[model samples]
Target: MTERPNMETRTILRVIVCDNDIRKIVLPLKPQTVDSLLEQLEEKLGLQYKFTLQFEDPDFNNSLVNLTDIADLPDKPTLKIVSLVTTPTPSTADTEILSVASDDPCHSLRTAWPETFEIPNFPVDVEYRLRQGNLQYMRDQTYLQLSGELKHEILEKLSETIYSYKAYPNKEDFEAVAAALIKKHPCLTQPGSSKGWNGWYDSLRWKMGNYRSKLRRAGCLEVSINGGKRRGQQPQRNVKRPKRFEINFLPNFPDGEDEASMESKRKEMVEEMKKRRLNSALIAQNMNSTFALRRKELIEKEPAVKNTVERWPALFTNGQKSNVNARRTAVLHGLPLLLGEDPTDFYKTCFDCDSNEDMLDTAIGIMTVIPEDSPTVPYSLHLDATTTAIILEGTVVVDNLENVPQAMCLLFGLIYALNLEYPAALKSTFDFLQRVILSLGHKSLKPKIQSLKKSPNAVMFFHG
Candidate 1:
C-alpha cells in the first residue's frame, strides 16, 4: 500500500541574497528567529564579516528594516547584504575613545516603511507594476538576460504599441519601441556581438514600409495628388541672359560746331570695336587649340587597329552592300563546315544573291536546311545583309514565305551576330529589330526579340 501525501507540510521558501556576488537559499516554512537565520547564512556561505540584510525592492526605494522573524518575510523574497563599518568616538575633553563592545545590529534600520508597501490600501494595476519593475531592472542592470518566451512577449508588446499609434513607423516610433523593449529586457540594449538599436530600427522601418505597401495594394490606404499649379501663380523660368558690353560715348560740344572732336570720337569707337573683335578671335583660337589637344590625347590612348579588329570583327565591316553581302555569304557557307558537312550548296546559293529579294530567298532557304534542334540557330542568322535591312524597314515582300516564323528567327539571329561583331551599331540594330517586331504584328515573337536585345552580348556592346 502507498502512503498518502501530507497536506499540512509547509512549502519551502526561497530567498535571493546579493552583495559582491549573487546567491539563493531555501528555508523551512516554519517560523524561525532572525538570529538563527543569520547564523545559518554565515555558516553555509562561509562569511567572516558581520552584515545587514535589506529587502530587494524593484523600485530600489525600500527602507532597510531590522529582521525580527523569518516568517515575516514574503515568499521568494530578494535581499541585499551590506557589510557593516564602525569608527571610534571623541569624549567631552576632545580625547579619542574606542568602544570595545560591538554596535547594535538594528541601530541603522529606518523607522518608516517604504511608500510602495505602505500603499496597500489603494488598488494597483498589475501591468503598470510590471512595467515599472522592468524599467527599474533596466536602470539597475547593464544587461538583462531574458528567456526566449520573455523576449517574444516584449517584442509583441512593442509591435502592438507601434501599430496602435501610427500607420507609418517613423524614427520617433522606433525610438519609443526600442526604449520599451530595453526597459522590458535590458539585454536587447547590449546584445553582445549582435545587432543593436540601429539594426532593429532599420528592420522596424522596413516592416512598416512593407505593411504600408500591402495596405496600399489592398486599396485601404488613401493617397492625395497635387493639382498642377495654384491659380494666379506664374511658373518660374530659368533663362540665361547674354552678357552686355559697357561703352563710353563722348559728350557733344555746346556750340555744335566741333566736327573735329566728333570725328575723333568716331575714330575712338571704331578702334574700341576692333579691339573687342580681336579679343573674341583670341578666345576662339584658345578654345580650338584646347579641343585639338584633347582629340590628339584620345587618339594616342586608342587601342591598335589590329587588336581592335581581332576583338571586334564587326568594326571591320564597312556596312557597304558588297562587303555586307560577302560577309553574310561567308558566315552562311561556314555554318555547314561547323556542322561537319559539305558546304558546296550553301556556298553557291548564299553567294548567288544579286538583289535584296534574291538575298531574302537564299536566307529563307538556308533556314530550312538547319536542323530544328541546332544550337547555332539561336545565336547566328542565315540572312544576308540586304535581307536584314529589308526586314528592319517592315517592307512588303513579293516572295511567298513558306515558314515565316523561321525567317523571323533568322532575322533576330542575324541581329545578335551583328551585335557581337559590330558593337558600334548595337543601339541602331536593336532599334531596327524593335521596329520590325512591332510591324510584323507577331506578339508571340516579341518576348524572344526582347530577350535577344537584353542578352549580355548586346548589353556589353560599345555603341561608340
Candidate 2:
C-alpha cells in the first residue's frame, strides 16, 4: 500500500507561556483560515516572527498549516477572543453535563467535593452502627447518609490507570490493564452495572469516556487502543520482498570507470559484494546503521570467525566476552554505536516527533554522535529530551548472540574514547553506544545516558 503523506489540518488554539514569560501560540488551524487567525495572533504576540501550524487531527492525512504564508497581520490590535480559558462558567454544557450523577467521578469529585463532609450533622456511622441503635441516644437526630465511598474508589482506580498510561503510554499495556479490570471487577469496569452509588454504572462510562478523551487530547494516544475490540483484524506478516527499481546508466559506464561504478556494472558483482539483507526495510528506517555489513563481516571470516567461535564457544552463551563480540559485529556491520550527541537535544526531537519511528532513529543517531569529533562522525546529532545515558555499574545483559560481538565493539570504542580527546573518537564511541542500546529497545537506554550527560559531574562516571 502506498503510504499517505501528512495532511494539512486545523486544531483548537491552545495558548502557551514560554520561559521568557511571553505568551506563544501553538496551532492546529486551517491553512487559509489560520492565516486570518495569525493576523489576530501577531497583534496579540506584539512581535514580528514566523510561525508554523501543526495538524492536530489524528484521523487526518496531512495536518500542517504554515504561518509563513500570511501577509501582514496587524502589529497590535484589540484581540477579540472566542475561547478564553477562564474558570469555566458553572452553567456551561461541559460543566453542567459533567456535574450530573452520570459524569466521571473525578469530575464529580471536583464539582461536589466534600459533599458529606461539609454537613456536620450527617451520619458518619457505618451500617452496623445504625443497626445497633447507636444514634438513638442523640437528642438531636440528623438525616443519615452513606459515604460516596464506592464512587470515590472507582474514580481513584480509573485515575490510576489513566495516569499510568500517561507516564509510560503503551497502548497494549494500557488496554491489557483496562481489559483485566473489566474481566475481574465487572461492576467497576462495566458501563452501567456498578453497585452502591445512584448512578454508579453511568459514572464508570463517564470515567471511561473522560479518561479516553484526556488521553486523545494529549495527542500521543493510540487510536487502535481506544477503539476497544472494534479495531480491525491483526495485520498480516510482511513477507513480500520490496520491489527494486533498476536504473540503466549511459553506455560509456558499461565497464564502470571507477571501482564503485565497476562494482555497480558487474551483474556478477552482486554475488561478490553480498548486499546486507535487512530483516525488513522498515527496520532500516530507524536503525542507525546497516546490519548487512555486520552480517557480511561474519560471512567473510568464516574461517577466523569460525576459529573464534570454536575457541571461545562460550561467546555464543550469555557471557561478557560474548556480549562484547556481538556488539563489535554490530558496529562493523554499521549499526549506530552511541547514545547521541547530546542526550537532551535528541530527547526533544524524539518527543516532538511523537515517537515517529524513522524520525526517532535519525534523531537518536544525531544526538548521540560525539560532537567534538567530526569527519569520523559529525556533531550536532539529533535527539529528544527523554534520551538518557546509562552508567552500567556491574554486568550488562546480552539479549542475543548478535549482541555479544556488538557489545565488545562498543566497549572497545568506549575505552578508546575514554583515554583520548579526539572529537572523532568521541563521536565514534557515542555511535557505538547508541547501537548497543538500540538492540534492547530505544526506550530502555535513553534515560540512563541522558541523566549522566546532563549532570555537572559527568566526568566521575568514566572511572566508576
Maximum-lDDT candidate: 1
Candidate 2 has its poorest 10 consecutive residues by lDDT at 246-255
For all predicted structures, in order, the TM-scores are 0.17, 0.16
Candidate 1 lDDT, 81-153, residue by residue in tens = 4345311001101011111122211111111111111111112343444455557666775454545555445
lDDT of 1 at 351: 22
Report the error of model 1 at residue 99, Å.
Answer: 74
Cand. 1 TM to true fold: 0.17
Q: Please identify model 2 stretches exceeding 4 Å from their true place.
A: 1-153, 162-199, 223-274, 277-464
Computed on alpha carbons, the lDDT of every model, listed in order, comes to 0.35, 0.30
Clash tally, candidates in order: 1, 66
TM-score quality measure for candidate 2: 0.16
**Best prediction by TM-score:** 1
The regions of model 1 sitting more than 4 angstroms off are 1-153, 183-187, 192-196, 213-219, 222-464
- The predictions' CA RMSDs to the true structure, in order, are 42.9, 24.7
Assess the local accuracy of residue 348 in candidate 2 as a C-alpha lDDT between 0 and 100: 15
Q: What is candidate 1's CA lDDT for residue 106?
A: 12
